[model samples]
Target: MTGRERHGTGARLRRMLAYAVLILFALVFLYPFVIQTATAFKTEPDAAAHPLSPIPDPVTTEAFAQVFGGTGFPLWVVNSLAVTLLITAGRVFLDSLAGYALARLPFRGRGAITAMVLAVMAVPGVVLLIPKFLVLNQLGLYDTYTALVLPLIVDAAGVFIMRQFFLSVPPSLEEAARMDGAGVFRTYWSVILPMARPALITLTILSFQSSWNEFPHTVVAVQDPALYTLPRGIANLVAGSLGAGTQYPLKLAAALLATIPVAIIFIVFQRYFVRGAAEGASKE
Candidate 1:
C-alpha cells in the first residue's frame, strides 16, 4: 500500500480499538444498574439464584408494594422531594446572584470575596460534618426541615460554577443593559440570566441530584424518622429494622425510586450537562 493508505489503515485500527475500550467501559459501569433493576422485580429467592441476570424469573411487585405500603418509603420520598426542591431552588438563585456579583460587579474587596469562595470550595465536605451539627444545634435548627434545607441552600461549588459561566459570557450584554438605565440586579435578572439557561439547568440538575442522594448531612441534621429523607430512610432499610433478611429486591426497588428523579433530569438535559462539563473543564 502507499504511505497514505498505510496511515489511514493505522488510524482506522486505533479508532476500532478506542470503540472497543469504550464499549467495555460502558458495560462495566452499566451492568450493575441493569442487574439492580432486574433484581428489584425478582422474587427474593430468584434474585439470590441469579445475582447477575438482567431478566428476573417470575417477576413480582411484592417488594415495591412493601416499600410503598409497609415501610417509611413514601414518607422518605415526600421528604426527599421537599428538601430537594427547596435546596435546588435556593442554590440556583443564590449561586447565580453571588456568581454574577463575583463575575461582573467591580466592588471593593471583590477579590477577597472570590478568594474566600474558592477556599470554601476547597474544604472537604466530610470535614464539616461535626462543625455543621454543632452550629445547627446552637441555632436550634436541629431536627427541623430548616436544618436540612437551609445549610445546603448556598453551595460554594454552585457559586463557583455560576461565576465561571458568567465570566465566560461577554460583558457587552450587561453593558448594553446598563446603557439602557438598567441597574446591576436588573441587568443580571433580565439580560444576563436569560442567557445563562444552560448553566442554570446544569446547576439545578446537579443540586437536585446531590441533595436527593445526600446521606451524611441528613444524619447530622435530623434525628426524627418522620424527617428522614430517602437516602437516610434507605440506609435505615439496609442497616436497621428492614435489614433483617436478604431483602435485595426491596432494597433495590427503593434505590431505583430514589434514582428516578436524577435519571429523568439527566436524560432530559443531557446536552446542557455535557456543555456544563465542557465549561467546567475550560474554566479549570
Candidate 2:
C-alpha cells in the first residue's frame, strides 16, 4: 500500500478504538442509573429475581405512593427543599461577596484572609463533622435549621471560584464604573455582577446540588426526624422498615426522586457546568 493509504488506515483504526473505549466507559458509568430506574417500578420479588433487567415485568407506582404517603418522605422533601434553597442562596450571595472583595479590594490583612481561605479549603470536610457538632451544640444551635444552613453559608470552594472568575474578567470594566462615580458596592452590584451571570449560575447549581445531596453533614447536625433532609430520611428508611423486605423498588424510587431536581438543573445548565469544568481545569 502507499504510505498515505497506510496512514489513513491507521487513523481509522485509532478512531474506532477510541469510540469503543468511550462506549465501554459510558456503559460502565450509566448502567447503574438505568438499573436503578428500571428496578424502581418492579415488584419487590421481581426486583430480586431480575436484578440486572432494565424492564420490570409488572411496573407499578405503589413504591412512590408509599414514599409520599406512608413514610415521612413528603416532610423530608419539604425540609430538603427549604434547607437546600437557604444554603444555595446564602452561599451564592456570601461567597460571591467574599470572592469579589478578596479579588479586587485593597485592604489590610487581605493576604492573610486569602491564605486562611485557602487553608480552610484544604481541610477535609469529614474532619469537621465532630468539631462542627461540638460548636453547634455549644452555641445551642444543634438540631435546628440554623445548624444545618449556617455552617455552609460560605463555602471556600465557591469563594475561590468567584474570586478566580472575577480575576479573569478585565479590571477595566470596574474602573469604568468607578470613573462614572459608582461606589465599590455599586460597581459590584450593578456592573460586575451583571457580567458574572455565567459563573454565578454555575455556583448556584453546584451549591444546590451539594446541599441537596448532603448526608453526612445532616447526620451530624440533626437527630430529629422532623429535621431530616431527603438523603438522611431515605437512608433511615432503607436502614429501618424498608430493609425488612426486598423493597429495592421503593428504595430506588426514593433515590430517583431525590436525584431528579439536581438532574434537571444539570441538564438545563449543562453549558454552565461545562464552562465551570473548563475554568477549573485551566486553574489547575
Model 1 lDDT, residue 187, Cα: 94
TM-score of every prediction relative to native: 0.96, 0.96
C-alpha root-mean-square deviation, each candidate: 1.4, 1.4
Q: Give the lDDT of residue 218 in candidate 2.
A: 91
- lDDT tens string, model 2, 1-284? 99999999999999999999999999999999999999889888899999999998898888888888878888998999999999999998999999999989999999999899999989999999999999999999999999989988889989988888887778899889999999999999999888778789889999999999999999889999899999999898788665477678888899999999999999999998788757755754
lDDT: worst 10-residue window of model 1 = 237-246
Candidate 1: misplaced stretches above 4 Å? none
Question: How many clashes (backbone N, Cα, C below 3 Å) per candidate?
Answer: 0, 0
Query: What lDDT does the true structure give each of the candidates?
Result: 0.92, 0.90
